[model samples]
Target chain A: MSIETDIKQKKFRSPYQRLALNLIYTSNWIQYQQVDGFREHDITSQQYNVLRILRGQYPSPIKVSDIAERMLDKNSNTSRLIDKLLAKKLVDRKSCPNDRRAVDVVITEAGLELLKKLDPVVDEWDNNMNAITHEEADLISSLLDKIRESKNNN
Target chain B: MSIETDIKQKKFRSPYQRLALNLIYTSNWIQYQQVDGFREHDITSQQYNVLRILRGQYPSPIKVSDIAERMLDKNSNTSRLIDKLLAKKLVDRKSCPNDRRAVDVVITEAGLELLKKLDPVVDEWDNNMNAITHEEADLISSLLDKIRESKNNN
Candidate 1:
């Protein structure tokens, strides 16, 4: 449905404003869908994001700052997020051997197992976007990249 | 920067997966920037969203369900969100004149004043998107709309 119909708003002043609102609205919608999927496994989306990042590292320990830089929400407090994960025993933290200021994080066996269990769920959840076709998906991705392209020059 | 550089992840199995991840990631990035702006005003982004919806109703009393329907996050709990706004005195609620099951809500004077104070902040906040040009923004918006469009059978 058009955002206009979806929200029952009368009209947007301009395509620019519409685009801004649509991007924010659609993204939040997708996030909520993902969040609900994660809830079945007893995890928040951010926690799932961290687990994915750690899984990417696998046997190698990742630094907290590195994880922060890689997070979907860039400005998130990595230290605090890591603290939450640590409490859940989903990840392990240790002082970086080279830089004491950095903390090395590794996904635990339990964490990897959880992700393996979640692999099908992740597949099913993202597949919800099957409402969209591959061509449109590629187009959307390219457009999003273009939206952030200006940030590249800076 | 690309989500690749931002997240330090190397691979995406397909453009579809890449687009899904990019949309979610870029949207979150934009949201974080917005949250920082709202944070300065001591309101979370979600709270600010509620205030804007209420302001749209102005003198006309809106119901909790109305606000929820118009919200950007479709699944948000309108009653709970309103409870927070009510506690903050940013909104006034009374028993609906016609529907006992519904509560009438209006932006309080304080709420309108606060939003007025936030006007410049919102404009300044929008400038952060100067990272993206107006044309790019429009294209991005159109692409997202298409992404949500379904092929007849799906």
Candidate 2:
């Protein structure tokens, strides 16, 4: 199950190239695995991410910009995502009392309920990582952290 | 920076959860790094991936479905992506001679030229991985492969 075989490519120009492709491909693979579970609950992973962020804040609402900053996929249109969640009545958007020009977004009761249902789905996903040991997971996480170290400085 | 600081979160439920988030976040981080370069050439990363797939099959045409199978991002609408590339004149689409019902796709001369210009951008990205050693890259690539091993079985 090497990347070469998975992608049907015979070789890479370098290890870094292979690693680069591996990271993107594996990330997509993980997301695809969750698609069915997320679709069952009628939410895309990004929307689920938004709901989770709001749930984390609970009673306190956060600005759309802050949600965008924390989103795993930075390119997602935060405002548009909020609009969709609002349409579904899973989230509430209101003018910020502290900053009238800004908007505050909070998860509604339905959103929290949806996440409560989704908790096991996510837990199953985490459990699947049991294929790799805890020490390995820690090592991989640290390596990923190191990979992003240089980018943070810039 | 650690995933915690990067996402502005203070905790993860477990190491596996941390690893999962790290994988997605780092992958997106890598992609965002390439956006500006791809944008300069008027293509999204998914489009870039399509062009590369076509380039790999150069001197021969491929079917849209085949392109989808080879794509890194499984959720990308391959046909729509080809339509965009077609509009931009970066690729050519024609009816298959053998299977009239199937459409064939090939990278145009313009597409090849665009990739040539993008070579440096991609090279710079590979170079940035100097933050991690070649050994670390290899290790990560293997770990990712291991992570997907279970998924491939299903």
Candidate 3:
């Protein structure tokens, strides 16, 4: 559905405004779809993101700051997210060997296992994009990249 | 910057995965831009969204459930958001006359003024999209609509 119909708004101030709202609305729509699957595993989308990052660097721990930098949500409280993941035994933290003041985080075996279980859910999410062709996916990705170009220059 | 450069990751499982990540990352980028402006007014983005929804129905009140339905984030605690906005004197809430079981919410004069102040910030956001042509904006919006079509059907 178009954003206007989905939100029940009749109009937008401009095409840029419509694009802005559509991007946000669509992002939220995607998150909502993932939340149910993440909730089933007692984790959040942010936590799932964290685990995936750690998995990408498996066997090599990453610093909290690095994790924050890689996170999709720039505002997420990395320390707090780490604390929750720790409680869940899905991740482990250790003092950085070279940097005394820094802590390194790594996904535990359980974390990897959990992500393995979530593979199908994540796959289902990716499959949903099949509604748009590969060319369309590439176009959307580049357009999104272009949208951020102005910000990147600043 | 490409999504890989932004996140410092070199690989994605597929183009669809890359597009999904880019969509989410770009959305967060837009939100972070808005957060600074909204923060100055002491309102979270979700609260700002709620206020905008109420403004659309100014001079008339809306039910909490209706506000929830219109919200970008489906998981937002609408009643609690209204409570905070009420405490800040940005909105007024009362029991519904037609349906005693439902509560109605409306933007206060203060709320309208707050949104007025936020207009420039929102405009600046829209201006940022000028990096992309009007045609590009239209294409992106339609592509996003296509992306959501699969979910909407279910």
Candidate 4:
């Protein structure tokens, strides 16, 4: 199905316009799909992202700034997001022992268990992309990397 | 220049994984840029999207469902978004003359004025694509189109 039919829009001004719309559209589409997967466990995609990040730092505490820096959406209010996860006991936060200005965050055992369950679901979620072959996926990946390359100089 | 440095990530399992991350990361980057542009005018990207949809239906009111159907992010709450636009006096909403169950929405003069003001900003936004040549833009666009084409059968 063309994007025209997908959104019921007639046409785009140019392919760049089309690409811009499509990147946002497809990314949002995949995000919603991921959200649905997380819904079974009553978590939003952002929460899941936080959980994964915390898991990466399991056994070692990480600072809020570090998590925010590593997040897919860098500007996300991770302080608030961590607060939410803390409310659910999926993550534990405390003032850093050596650096009081920073807060330490770590995933809990329950959180790890939850992610263990979610791992298979995430795999299946990526399976959604099986429609595109690995070759196409690689090509698209390289192109996107190139697209962001210019931002490096600035 | 690589996504590795851009996000400061250590590794990806495969190009497919990288593509997935890049799509989401780049899309959000573009959206945040637009958000800054829209914020200067006191409107959000979602609000701008709604006003554009209403303009597409000028002289004939459109329904909340119609707006949802045409939105880039279908999961967004159209009713709530429209309510915000209504509060701002950017749009008018009333019961459809033909169907009381349906609400009709149309952009007000103020809304069109806002859009007119936003037009050049949007064009400048598009011009940012000049970072990628027309040829690269087309390639990116085609690649994204193909990516979504796989979504059709599902």
lDDT of each: 0.77, 0.87, 0.89, 0.81
Q: Score the docking of each candidate (DockQ).
A: 0.46, 0.70, 0.73, 0.55
What clash pairs does model 3 have? none
lDDT of 4 at B28: 89
Q: Which regions in candidate 1 have their CA more than 4 angstroms from the true location? A: A80-89, A149-154, B40-42, B75-77, B80-90, B108-110, B113-139, B146-154
Please give, for residues B6-66, the per-residue lDDT of candidate 1 as tens digits: 6678887556667768877877767777787777677877788889888877889999888
Superior candidate under DockQ, 2 versus 3: 3
Clashing residue pairs, backbone N/CA/C < 3 A, model 4: none
Residue A119 accuracy (lDDT) in model 1: 81
Candidate with best lDDT: 3
**Model 3 global lDDT (CA atoms, 0 to 1):** 0.89
TM-score: the better of candidates 1 and 3? 3
Per-residue lDDT tens digits of candidate 4, residues A1-154?
A: 5666777777666666677778888899888878777887988888888888788767898899988887889889998998889988999888998988999999999999999999877776565677677887777666667666654445
CAPRI band of model 3?
A: medium
Summarize candidate 3's per-residue lDDT along B51-133 as a digit string, tens digits: 98999999899999999998888788998999999999999999999999999998999999999999888988888878788
Off by over 4 Å in 3: none
Candidate 2 chain A lowest-lDDT run of ten? A5-14
Q: Tens-digit lDDT track for model 4 on B1-154?
A: 5667666666665566677788898898889889998997889999999998888788789989999999999888999999899999999999998998999999999999999998887876665666577787776666666666776666
CA-based DockQ, model 1: 0.46
Winning model by TM-score: 3
Recovered native contacts in candidate 1, as a fraction? 0.55
The best-first sequence of candidates by TM-score reads 3, 2, 4, 1
TM-score of 1: 0.82
Native interface contact recovery, all models: 0.55, 0.69, 0.72, 0.59
